[model samples]
Target: MPELPEVETVKRSLERLITGSAITDVNVLFPKVVKSHTPGDFKASLAGCKIKSLARRGKYLLVHLSGDKTLVIHLRMTGRLVYLEEKDDLPRYAHVIFYLEGGKRLVFADMRKFGHINLIPTAQLKNMPELKKLGPEPLGKEFTVQYLQQELRKRRTKIKALLLDQTFVAGLGNIYADEALHLAKIHPERTAQGLTGSEAAGLHHAIIKVLEQGIKNRGTSFSDYVDGEGNIGTNQYQLKAYQREGEPCSNCGTIIERKKVAGRSSFFCPQCQSSKR
Candidate 1:
């Protein structure tokens, strides 16, 4: 699944490519992909509306339209939103295609068909159930070290599991969680409340650092993630712990190990991130 960095990369690329372009037509090849309204209404609402801007909330992409409506997209697992220079052949899994002015195309392709789109009044965006329940963005001002320390002090859940909780900290998935924990030298199975203030501070810094690096590298593209131009990211080559099981740790000579924590595979250096808690 695409996490914060991947989604943010797509949002930035789409903002550059599609803002100010008018949506002349919309074709919904898979009706189930339209979650907010019927496919017919979805198509009718978007016709001739200019794209105002693009924003991202957690893993959700927000396409602000001219008529006070927002197109919300969640690219679950294997979804890709590609912007084409011309009206070429539709990609194999293209489920939704938005025809822009001047013969351009914005295609939503999902190989697993689990991705979803919603159209809602822009005025009601903040109060929507999906946006309302999400926790603070890690890159935002609200996610300070003090805030992280306080949150960690209250949770008994394992640190890795807590980080993966969208309600605890938005946009962190399995890959980044493992990387952040490895950077902080904290065991994935360590209880959140067991972390000292210094450990929490280290974790806060590590989380922000890893996320920033992920964005700088344009997100880890081990699977289906790509920017709006369909360019694969280079971050996968920069991974230190995630999916590097049996590899040498960059910090220590110890071999990286993988363990299951909270039903997700977590990779860490046993020497650096000892399970002392």
Candidate 2:
């Protein structure tokens, strides 16, 4: 799953590659990938539209077209957007190809076929279910310590579960959540209500710091994530938690441990993060 950093990286890459280019054609190799309308309608709606800009909200990519229709893409698990100078052989998983005017092609490929694309009217974008439900972005100004405390106070869910909740804090997925929690020295199993104001403040800082660093590192390429240039991210090399199951903790030298929290694998050092609530 490409979280905020990964999605942000892709948005930047796509913006550079496809902005101002006209979509001369759209080939939907997988009909299931088009959600807003039939594949024909989706293709017709975007064929001649010029891509004005590319932006991101939460984990969704927003490609703003000239006529105010937004192309929304969620690279759910294994999806990637690659920019090619020329089409020779489409990747085995290429599901959607947007033919550009200059012979360039923007390809969306998903090996697992879980990604989705929707052509939406920009006027209705704010009210769309996905964007409407997202909380303030952790990297944005609205996500302050006071705001985080308000959202977490009295919430009985585990801290990790609360962080993973899209409505609780937008743009966080498994990797960054565990990294933030580990940085804050908070146990994933601890209830949100158990956190003190200082703890919340620490978490507030941790979230922003880790997200900024993730973006700087081009996002963690734990799986099949890549930028528009077909480049694999190298942030996996800098991970403090998330997959170093039995390795020694970088900060305290305690053995890094893994457990299931909120049905997602959590990585942390037991010594660094106290589980006692």
Best by lDDT: 1
Off by over 4 Å in 2: none
Clashes of each: 0, 0
What TM-score goes with each of the models?
0.97, 0.98
On residues 1-277, what C-alpha lDDT tens digit does candidate 1 reach at each position? 6899999999988888899999999999999999987878988999999999999998899999998999999998889998998746778899999999999999999999999999999999999998899999999999999999999889999999999999888899998999899999999999999999999999999999999999999988997889898888888999899999999999988999998999999899999998995
lDDT of 1: 0.92
lDDT of candidate 2 over 221-276, digit per residue (tens): 98798888878788899989889999999999999999999999999999999998
Model 1: how far residue 202 lies from native, Å: 0.5
RMSD of each: 1.0, 1.0
- Residue 5 displacement (Å), model 2: 0.4
